[model samples]
Target chain A: MKLEKLDPTVKACTSLVCVILLSFQYLVSLNIAVFVLSLLLLLTCTRARGIQVLKLLLPALVAAFGLFVTGYFHGRGTRAEDLQKIAAMPYAVRAAMSTGLYPALQISTRLLAYAGFGLLFALSTDGEAFIFSLMHRCRLSPKFAYGILAAIRLMPNMVREFKSVRLAFRARGMQLRWYSLPPVFTMLVNSIRWSQCVAMAMESKGFDGDAPRTCSIVPKLRWYDLAFFSCWITGILVGMCLLRY
Target chain B: MKWKLKDILMIAVCAVLFGVIFLGATYAGGALYGLLLPLGMPSLGYEPFYGLYFMAVAFAVYVIRKPGVGIVAEILAAVIETLMGNFFGPIIILSGFVQGAGFELIFALTKYKRFDFKTMALAAVICSCVTLGYNLIVSGYDMIALPVLALMLAVRIVSAVVIDAIVTPRLADGLARAGVLGGYAVCEGVAKDLDC
Candidate 1:
């Protein structure tokens, strides 16, 4: 399937639903199957694009691993029974520890599932088309919808402006802390001014909220989107039913 | 009142700024979480970073003083973050919607009139509850023991208060004092004093 042809709204809705279902599912095999399937779909859709997905998934994977470890230690197994079992042990080894597989699997798989679905939706869906569909299909107000679109478009320039601002601060013998609030304030004030200019320009060009307007390109659901959605839905249902749970 | 272009632009620009902030915070928080997890102390990536999530939402409300601006600003931030290849993906958007609604509800209940420190703190509490609820549902945090959950909630609330309530109102006021927010709602509240 060509990435551009997929309806953005459909992709978003389908992936969201899949992620929700996968969150509830805890079986390791089922999760691995779903993750594999999602990965395959991603690769199948766009092999080159899948590389980007893999790159983005790294942080999520690390987070998932952390969650798994946290769940293993802090899970419900810390009750009095497990506490006694721990005290009597010669040492706290992996073998001596009570099982945490179920909960840990649940957490990691849920994280992976979220990453999988997130990549699927984000990698394939066009941001502009998604915003357009939000207005046309979801009935978001144009003021807000186009505002978001404008913001999305401003992201690159915003990044550039942030760099330039930081450079100016650095040249002035100022070192900005990564988590410090001062640079954020500077960037925000500057961006607010930029947004004002954009708003003025847009209003001058007659972007009246009360006025009727038409889109240059309208997004409509097509057969491929329906097929894509149904396939995922059926796969999820089957996966749910097959899991022994 | 009909929302003007300036209002929309404020929301958009703020959303972009905060979205970038959020992405950066998530990376830093992720690294911190990675280090802390091995130290046998888990923050779940929320305790340290939770404040960044709601700062923009509260600031947007303070600036716009509109009913749905919190959610609007948050959802736009979520979109921008998604475009920036957020590891949490679109689910962060869902979290954004829920978190923003938490603040929006508080602001709406106050009739969008109260911008005090107490109101912002209370709003942060509500936002923390929403975050906890979402985690319980998706992250299986419900399966954890009560003490751990309480501690996580405590950290989240404290972060939200310190950042969202304290820092954000002051920042918004600072921007207003700088004459940048001349036509916005925050300015209107102090218009007489500032002679706007």
Candidate 2:
């Protein structure tokens, strides 16, 4: 099934749970399975293009490579005695092949698994749908929910304002560093004013925070959402158990 | 406890702006992490940018001076960052919560009355420690050598204290002095100080 068809909350929860579960274990096979499965599903089922996914995965790949090198040299199991502990484990547990190699593989692969789950949720879920789901399913306050939706709408304009401010500064022959306060101050001042205007406009339109309101676009949960959640969780759990030997 | 529409929008806008910055920092941090890999301390790459992560919390609480503003602002920023296609994905929302709770605890202890530099610095320190503990688990910092871990902690604390604590308050005050934050608590505080 396509992940995009699933509820946003379910996708988010599944990704979070998968990350948490994968963080505690040193099972290389489970991490690889998750990373591969997520990637395959993302490519085949989701609308996310392979190129876009590859671009996003580049950072994860780089980070994983760095972590692998770090973990190999500085990992807790670097000592020879630590190597003995690995050999004593069952056949399935010695998948790392040598001392310090287990953590190197585990951490680097776990990073990939995390990136996979993260990409799965991020690429498939729509922002508006997620906020609506939070409101309808999670009982988020209308004040905050609508506030977020409005902010999302304003994001493009905010970006434009940011650029114009920087350009205006440059026009004055002032080169503002990224860490400079003047540009941020200008932006904050504008933001405060804009926020006031937005608030006034919203209030004028009878947007009451306390009053119960109905949403025209309510995100509903379906049976497949449940199925997807369970399958994702159980698949990882069972995979970990089997890999434990 | 009552939040005006204006207040909520203020938080939302500020969170959105900072969320964009956070996304940029994440990319920069990723690059730095890759560069520092050969140093055997790849985790230190993001420490310098740690202060930027907590700016939403500091900005919101300092200007709004309300209960729970820090947590709300931080989480909202995380949500915005997530929606903007941050590579870290939804897990950041959880990190936001943990990071928010760090400073929120400090502000709550002060009963939301004190907005002094001392209080803000202390809150930043507490926040750094809290996030460090969370990172130890999620990022597996516990696996690294102890000296490297300690260095990372020190750098993060200094970043948090310098930017979120020192720079943010002064920046907000500058905005207030410019007379743009007129309706907010920061403006009100400035007005009262002038009257004195």
The model with the greatest lDDT is 2
Report the lDDT tens digits of candidate 1 across residue range A1-245.
66557877777778778777766655556677777777777788654365687787787787778777777777655444444544555564535445665556666777777777777666766777777887777777788777777777777887787788888888999988766556667777787778888889988998876668888888888889899889988988897787543
Can you tell me the CAPRI class of model 1? medium
Listed per candidate, the RMSD to the true structure in angstroms reads 4.6, 2.9
Off by over 4 Å in 2: A78-85, A88-96, A176-180, B191-196
Q: Which 10 consecutive residues of model 2 chain A have the lowest summed lDDT?
A: A76-85
Computed on C-alpha atoms, the DockQ of candidate 2 is: 0.63
Prediction 1 global C-alpha lDDT? 0.75
- Which pairs of residues clash in candidate 2, taking residues 3 or more apart in a chain or in different chains? none
- Provide the TM-score for each candidate, comma-separated: 0.89, 0.91
Q: Residue A67 deviation, candidate 2, in Å?
A: 2.3
